[model samples]
Target: MRWSRHPRCVSLARAELRTALAGWGLLVLEEAAVLVLSELLTNAGQHARVSPGREIETRFRPVGDGVRIEVHDASTVLPEERRPEYDECGGRGLILVDALTDCWGYGERSGPGKMVWAELRAGSG
Candidate 1:
C-alpha cells in the first residue's frame, strides 16, 4: 500500500496491517508488528528528504510462518540505531524496532530509495 507523507498514514497503515495479520491468522505477532510498523513509517515520514508529494509505500506479507513488514520511501538515507541520552525525548524509534523485531534491516530498493523492513515470527515479541 502506498501512503502519503503525513502523520495520519501511520494509523492508516496500522489498521491495514491489523487486518492483514488477522486474515493471515498471525494475531500473535500483531502488537509487536504494529509497533514496528509505526516506528518505520514515522521515521520515513519524518526523515525522508525527498521531493514534495513523494509517497511512501508499505508492503505486508507472510514470510514462512512469520510476517514481513516493509516501508519504502523515496530517500536514500538509511536509519541508524543509537542510544538516546537520559534527557533526550526523541531518537529512539529504531531502538524500539530492534528490540521488538526478530530481525530488521534496510537495503536498496528497485527504484530511487531504500526499503526498511522487519520480520516477526509468531512467538517473538
Candidate 2:
C-alpha cells in the first residue's frame, strides 16, 4: 500500500500489523514486522531517491509461518546490512533489521525501483 510520511502512516502500519498478528498469533513476529517496517520507511524517507509526486510503497505477505514485509523505494540502489564499527552512529538500520529477522534481502521491483524485504517466523519454526 501507499502512504505519506505523515504520522497517520505509522498508525496505519501499526493497525495492519495488529490485524496480521491477530490471525497469526505471534507477538515476536508482529514486533519484528513493525520494526522492519519502521526501519524501511525511515530509510526510504531518508536515503531513497525521491522526486516530485513520489511516495513509498509497502506490502506484507505471509509465507508459511513467517511474514514478509517488503518496502519499495524509487531508487535502484539496494540497502546493505553493513556492520559498522562501534564508534559510528549511523548505518545500523539494516544491520539491526538483519539481526532481528529470520531473513532479509533486496531485489528489483516491477518498475525501475527496488524492494527491500525482511522475513520473520510467526512462531518457533
Candidate 3:
C-alpha cells in the first residue's frame, strides 16, 4: 500500500500490518512486526528526501511462520545506524529493529529509492 510522508502514516501502516498478520494466522509475531514496521516507516518518512508529493510504499508478506515488512520511499538515501549517547533523544530505530528481527536490510527498489525490509521469525520466542 502507498502512504504519505507524514508521521501519521506509521499507525496506519501498523494497522494494515496487523490485519495482514491476522489474516495469515501470524498474530504471534504482531508485536515485533509492528515495531519493525514502525521504525522502517518512520525512518522513511523522516529521512527520505524526495520531491514534494512523492510518497512512501509498504508491503507485508507471510514468510514461513513469520511476517516480512517492507517500507519503500522515493529517495535513494539509505538509513544510517547510529550509536547515540545515553542523553540523546532519538536515533535508535535501527538498533531496536536489529535486536527484534531475525534479520533486516535495505536495497535499491524498482522505480526509485530503496526498500528497507525486516523478517520476524515466530520461533524467536
Identify the candidate with maximal lDDT: 1
Mind giving the per-residue lDDT tens digits that candidate 2 earns over 14-118?
678768767766555776678778888888777776775567788887888888888887887778777789999888998888778888888988876898888
**Residue pairs with backbone atoms closer than 3 Å in model 3 (clashes):** none
Error of 2 at 41 (Å): 1.5
When summed lDDT is taken over every stretch of 10 residues in candidate 3, the lowest stretch is 62-71
Span of 10 residues, lowest total lDDT, candidate 1: 116-125
Pairs with backbone N, CA or C atoms under 3 Å apart (clashes), candidate 2: none
lDDT for position 117 in model 2: 87
Q: What order do candidates take by lDDT, descending?
A: 1, 3, 2
Candidate 2: list runs displaced more than 4 Å. Answer: 6-8
- Provide the overall lDDT of each model, using Cα atoms, as 2-decimal numbers: 0.93, 0.78, 0.91
For each candidate, what TM-score against the reference? 0.96, 0.84, 0.97
Candidate 3: residue 102 lDDT (0-100): 90
Model 3 scores a TM of 0.97
Q: What TM-score does prediction 1 earn?
A: 0.96
lDDT of 1 at 36: 96
